[model samples]
Target: MTKSYVVRYVGGPLDGRVDTLPDLPDEPRSTVTHVHLHEGPKIVHHYDLCYAVEYGCEYRLRADADAE
Candidate 1:
């Protein structure tokens, strides 16, 4: 089975949300994409991995990416 890690979102609409995701690389920094429905269009948001915790990782919304 693939290893799963607890991921915590730090900012944006998903702030404070936690999810268990599989196969997140153990890198200091990385990007995760999220798709959401806004009105009738699908919007994509990018988050950057910023911190590592005991058993999880913390990702913050990218200001530049979120602006797009």
Candidate 2:
């Protein structure tokens, strides 16, 4: 099975967004991650484009799960 990575929004304007991706690059540029949020107990997946900073930003990059 293939592993996937996801970005969990902890703060900022893109809060409450959990996006999944197959792989994330280590370049200094902007990448889009699908933002998923729930409203009124309804699961809403917002394919919102979010800018990720490699140097300075409130967002961060980390492993979605343990790789085996």
Candidate 3:
């Protein structure tokens, strides 16, 4: 079975959202991109990896890219 990890998103519109991702490499991507689609156009949010926790990792939304 493949191992998965839980990712907690903090700040921005996606704050408090938790996602399950596949096994990550020793050095995971510094940032994660999320495409959000609501009623209108799609907005992209970039989250930077903060630190590792017991179960998985936590990512914070980048300030520069937090405009809605």
Most accurate candidate by lDDT: 3
Q: Say which prediction, candidate 1 or candidate 2, comes out ahead on TM-score.
A: 1
Model 1, 3-56: lDDT tens per residue?
A: 777788888789989888676755645888889986888877789887565655
Question: Using lDDT as the measure, what is the rank order of every candidate, best first?
Answer: 3, 1, 2
Candidate 2: which stretches are off by over 4 Å?
28-68
TM-score of each: 0.59, 0.35, 0.62
The best candidate in terms of TM-score: 3
Expressed as tens digits, the lDDT of each residue in 30-60 for candidate 3 is 8999898999999888999987666467888
| Poorly placed runs, candidate 3 (over 4 Å) | 1-4, 20-24, 52-56, 65-68
Kindly provide the TM-score of model 1 when superposed on the true structure, using C-alpha atoms. 0.59
Better of 1 and 2 by lDDT: 1
Ten-residue stretch with the least lDDT total in model 3: 59-68
Arrange candidates by TM-score, descending.
Answer: 3, 1, 2
Clashing pairs in 2: none
C-alpha RMSD (angstroms) for model 3: 3.8
Name model 1 segments beyond 4 Å from true. 1-4, 21-29, 52-56, 65-68
Clashing pairs in 1: none
Local distance difference test scores for all models: 0.78, 0.46, 0.83
Candidate 2 lDDT, 1-68, residue by residue in tens: 87665555644446665767686646523433434565655432223234456312324333344544
